[model samples]
Target: MTLYRATAPHGVRPSPNIWNHTSTYEIENRAVDPDGQLAAALREVASWRARTVLDLGCGSGYHLPWFAEEAAQVIGVEPHPPLVQLARRRTKRLPHVSVLPGTAQQIPLPDASVDVVHVRWAYFFGPGAEPGLAELDRVVRRGGTAMVIDNDGTRSTFGGWFRRGYPGVDPAAVERFWASHGWSRRSVDMGWRFTSRADLEAVVRIEFDHATAEAVLAEHWERHGEDSGGEGDSGLSVDYAVNLWWREY
Candidate 1:
């Protein structure tokens, strides 16, 4: 079930996949980064332990509890009212974690209020996200770190599918955008391992349009017939590449 608002807030770009297919999106979340490489990389740059952490575009508050475990204070900001409600419900028991209704272009927090900012697969995409970057600059204190994670469409099995799905996104331009902004990029290799083929297909369908999803699944099936057993026992595993863009304020 999806919730609808008569008029969405300004600067809010609805994500239909997550908004309409929340349960399937949850499965996608579970299937991503099983190795914890992204988390490890974030800690290596700036540890959030005992510091205030802001999770931008934190949908359904999936990662809020994880941050709350180490961060002295964890704030999850999302623009969608339904998602904001879901996030609040998820972190209701955690005193250190708070969910707020806000967008990347206009965050609700005060200046220099956060020590670390985590943005994963959110709206901080390259080129057109200057407003969000400005908001990041305003909220992240001096010496604080801000991390943005996005798919590296230059490599990996999932990368190939991503490139095909969104032909407009240029890998070179994206890299240049981050470099020009003084943000450093770290390429991390991760993998999606699903427990069942049905789970894998469901996640892929939400990620891409119908045709692209079908083609991707067909290619995947050809490459590794049922149960290609490697790192993933279920045989539905795909290598994924991601760029971790970060900067110290």
Candidate 2:
């Protein structure tokens, strides 16, 4: 029951899709990585159990509770005021979980404050994310690990769609950017599974522009036919690939 706000935070880059259509974004969050492959990969690289975890750009605090279940302390930093309030309200009952108003470029926490920093689809895109990366270096302890989850626009069904939707993003250039920065990447194959076709459509619409959305949905319809949610069809599922970028501080 979270409300959406039109007023975006000043001096912070706004995520238009999520800021404008929050409920739909929530559905997208639920629909992503249903098998928990990303979570498994993250734990394999750096386990947050018993450590202080920081969730950067934790929209609506959806992942905060999950991190709170294991981490000794969970801190969620978000620039959007409304989202900050939502995160705080969501984690109000959790004594160890705290949601703070801050941006990745200028994190409010002190130096070497967190053990594990988890940033999923947030500010760490590629070349322009150096400031955020610097903040991570400052906040993460000596032995801490920082992980950034971003769309791998090289392979997978959704990768093709991503390339088509955002033609500006070069997968090779992004790879080089991470490699130059000394961050290791593990490309993981993940899939989006929605319970209903309508839900799938809604999620896709938000992820892409109208033309791209229509084209993607039409392609899906053509592949799976009108009755796509049937047993024979792949139903409301899409093969998505993501790069789990990590670096030890």
Candidate 3:
């Protein structure tokens, strides 16, 4: 009786982050993008106010409440079972918000059903995401906008760190793929500011592979010092760069 099985063939795709470790991912979300730059970009693309919005891979429905504030209806689609349950609980108070277990490859929505689709730091990563793009064409109505936000691992301190951890990801190539497909890009300056060294380390550990996480942490402490800061506080901040890709149907 799951809509996900019908939409997502070959089963659910693997997620980079450990959504099972909810606390770790939550800290990561809080630590990143303290500024409202990403939200501003989304607003500029398409105001969800009074419109139907689809949040693909909306783990735990973190941003569902914000979208529900203005959107007439908000659909949060996540493949993970526990995360889906958590998302439902989180949005139980908001009648307009509904969470479903699904994948980006096959969105469980009708044709031309949504007015605005926003995907931020989700599973529609770089290459081999054409299926999701096809779904967008089917679900997004005319004049509707589809936006995707991802880390620009090409420049800046955060980019450098990401490159060190994931040498396989080619930011330039990813940009090219989007451009070739007629998606426009906008660069945003975001950053990670953690309250404590433990917080910083915890977020990093989830972000990268085990070996890469250890290496990155070692390098981080080496550059920033073991104390994180000169004083007693263990706070750390790193400037991050991101790319916002969008297209209109």
Candidate 4:
């Protein structure tokens, strides 16, 4: 019944798009990276100013404006039609920004055109992302930096929940995959701080399968209930770990 079901690209792997619901995903974006630490670090390393930047899998273009503020030009590529539309609308006023419907496997940009490429919670995770990585090799210019921000499911409370929700994922294997690919990892503490229990629950619901979501929520409540005053408290914070994997070519 989701809008993405009809318009999603064929022969593409399903992303961790949180049940394909954009509204909840927006709440998640707001709850994450409250201090702008991730952005600051990325800017420090990539230094996109006066350069052309590409945001692959840029759903809804949430970070496009920020990139446009510094980059000489910004391009957002997303496969989901509805999200691509939203991204275009979000950046309509920014003449230096463009949002196009495209998948990571087939980025709609010229070879060696981008100075920096960024993918956040998108593709280029674990197995089955070889095609996208190849595409990155083609699109990014020589000396360009490619950055991928993904959950480091090896440590932290949020990582524990992620491991419980998806037992099939091998954190060690994922780490090795990136390490073998010539990418360097930088651990980032981009935790989630929700303003209300409703926000927290909603995020959990989308993050996991129905049964897993329930189990995770129950575990969270049971562990923090007493200190949080029997579930009436609106605040919820989970220590999270993420890997900022990047490579300079």
Best candidate according to lDDT: 1
Estimate TM-scores for all models. Answer: 0.94, 0.93, 0.90, 0.90
lDDT of each: 0.88, 0.87, 0.83, 0.83
Q: After superposition, how far is residue 91 of candidate 2 from its true place, in Å?
A: 1.3
Q: Is candidate 1 or candidate 3 better by lDDT?
A: 1
Q: Evaluated with TM-score, which candidate comes out highest? A: 1
Q: What lDDT tens digits, residue by residue, belong to model 3 across residues 152-205? A: 888877788789877888887898889988999999887888877878888888
lDDT of 3 at 198: 79
Q: Is candidate 2 or candidate 4 better by TM-score?
A: 2
Q: How do the residues 85-161 of candidate 1 rate in per-residue lDDT, one tens digit apiece?
A: 99999999999999999989999999999999999888445788888899998999999999999998999999999
How well does candidate 2 score on lDDT at residue 173?
A: 87
Candidate 4, residues 1-249, lDDT tens digits: the string is 355666666545465553377888889988898776787778767999999999988888888998999899999998777778899999999999999888888888888999999889874455667778898899999989999998877898888888887788887887788888888888888888887777888888888889988987877878876456335553487788888989998
Task: Point out where model 1 deviates above 4 Å.
Answer: 1-6, 226-234
Q: Model 2 over residues 71-173: C-alpha lDDT tens digits?
A: 9999999988778898899899999999998888888899999999988887435777888888888999999999989998889989998999999998888
